[model samples]
Target: METESLVETLEAAGLSPYQAEAYVALLELGTASATDVAEASSVPAPRIYDVLRTLEEREYVETYEAGSLQARAHSPSVVLDDLRSRANRLEAAAEEVERRWEQPELEAGGASIVTQFRTVIERAESFIEDAAHQILLSTTVSNLQRLAPALRDATERGVSVRVSVHTDDAETRPDPTLFEGVCVEARHRPLPAPFVALADRRRASFAHHPDSYDRYGVLVNDRTHTYVFYWFFLTTMWEPWETVYEATDPGLPTEYLDIRHLVRDLRELNWQDAPVRLRVDGYETDTGEERTVEGTVVDVRVPFASEADTGFELAGRVTVVLDADGERVSVGGWGAIVEDLEGTRLTIVDAPTVE
Candidate 1:
């Protein structure tokens, strides 16, 4: 496997470029003077003193009176152990700040999220409140399934917890409900997303994907971001309890059925080039133009958020996937052709099932 990204790993492990260089040089040469370290590390002699000082404080390097200040590198494991112990202290400090202080401008920004899955659960559990209006969160199944307790604990604390899940394997036992003070429902949707957390919609957290060794997340406490996502992208389900089966009558257009069934048919018929179907709820309040909209996926270019850069347009036909209430949402052909991708939202333009 490729080694960790050197610049990122060294910085994360608490090393300045100069310090990291000095340590690596010491490791290479066994023991070296400041001048030797400077040469080996390619750090200038003037900056080497500051780097050595920081490394010494972090316990990654040791220095002695050897004819002009010789420095020695600590073992990798030793350096990491110290780094971790310091990290624990820092985490404790962060939790205290997260609790005791209202604003933590002085606290380090975005460094102390727990990495281990169980540890993340424990951290969430620790922060959970017993009041009714506590935290509101949504989770994908790929995550949180292992440490399902986080959801349960939040609910047990009477926090309003809303959950949506996507599953291809419908054969498993009914997944246990993870909350008590709130609603937990199971529904199938797209690939579960990572890093979705909103607390009371006033403060939100984004889960940054973990490093390859251990998965982790970054928490964003931005409220505007939370509000935008809540209104637009991360929609919580407001639907019926039972599975709404399709009508047996052939009068309806074939495209307006549950997308699960359509994908099944595609796989069953061995149609290698089937268009990606749009799963849409019927629409009302239209000029009847959408009634004849094709359900087949088409090529449409979607732009990334850029003005100067030519953007990504989804390749697919315009089709109405879901037309519930006033809004409609659909997946554009992922690689469609379009002049600009920035403003394009709907992919499959369509009419209602019946006017």
Candidate 2:
């Protein structure tokens, strides 16, 4: 087994079996004459000189006395150092060649199907690492566990990460503890089969075999296809699942952020012509005093066409609340809608199903 391993290693390193065996024999014997090396290594006596000479040329062996047949194996340290140096030189040359190489342009609407499970996971990880703005992803609980570390790393780098997980297993439900500090938000729903990841709305991948060990998937780069997938994620996978976790930065109160999401839910529900039980607690426009309104949403409008209407252009005083009669009031000036609405606790009842 040792001899076979040595021969294989030597062959991999560009040495012939005879040269490797001869070198190994010399190393074992410490020092030997050419005839002794051939007998010990089982090399044919006639060809031993040729093998030794080749090893000598490669500095794997050194003839002690140039005029005589005596030879010694190069010190293992010396041989390893030479090999490392050669490898580093080759790597540098490769980098230079790669720098000059031109990649072929990939035309739009081309899709590549990968049948390997590892390949799909590798592509998902690659997209997560490359994401700059946000990641929209849905998979099973086990799969989320597999990707949690990469997702955390991306979040730490200031990339936003939103994940939806489907779990049939009762023992695990997309453990948010795994991504406690890094993930921006995460939710759990029934298994959203065919795991998918859409990054920055630019790259997308969909698995055909999410539940099986033998997973097959398609990696898509076409913008149009990715956008379609993105909408599917937003409407189907992301919007329906209850948000199990949300990590907000220091500036905004956690409750304030909650209001933002709930308000968005209300807006979307209203847009679908569904009844919503959303109530807001804030200063009334007429009385300039704290008030509460609880009823079905009549209309939620963004009255300020641009920042110029608010005079504080960057403040983003865009959120306007209206009842059934078209009565409207600004929650917060420009950018502080949710924060402004949180003068006191606001109760938003569970949204009615949009059928």
Per-residue error (Å), model 2, residue 323 = 20
In model 2, what lDDT does residue 318 have? 41
Q: What TM-score does candidate 1 reach?
A: 0.30
What C-alpha RMSD separates each model from the true structure?
A: 19.1, 12.0
Residue 240 displacement (Å), model 2: 4.8
Q: Each prediction's Cα lDDT score?
A: 0.45, 0.64
Q: Ten consecutive residues with minimal summed lDDT in candidate 2?
A: 306-315
The local lDDT score (0 to 100) that residue 135 gets in candidate 2 is: 76
Name the regions of candidate 1 deviating beyond 4 angstroms: 1-134, 168-186, 207-218, 232-355
| lDDT, model 1, position 25 | 71
Q: Evaluate model 1: give its lDDT.
A: 0.45
In candidate 2, which residue ranges exceed 4 Å CA deviation?
Answer: 64-68, 82-111, 116-122, 125-134, 145-162, 169-187, 212-214, 234-236, 239-355
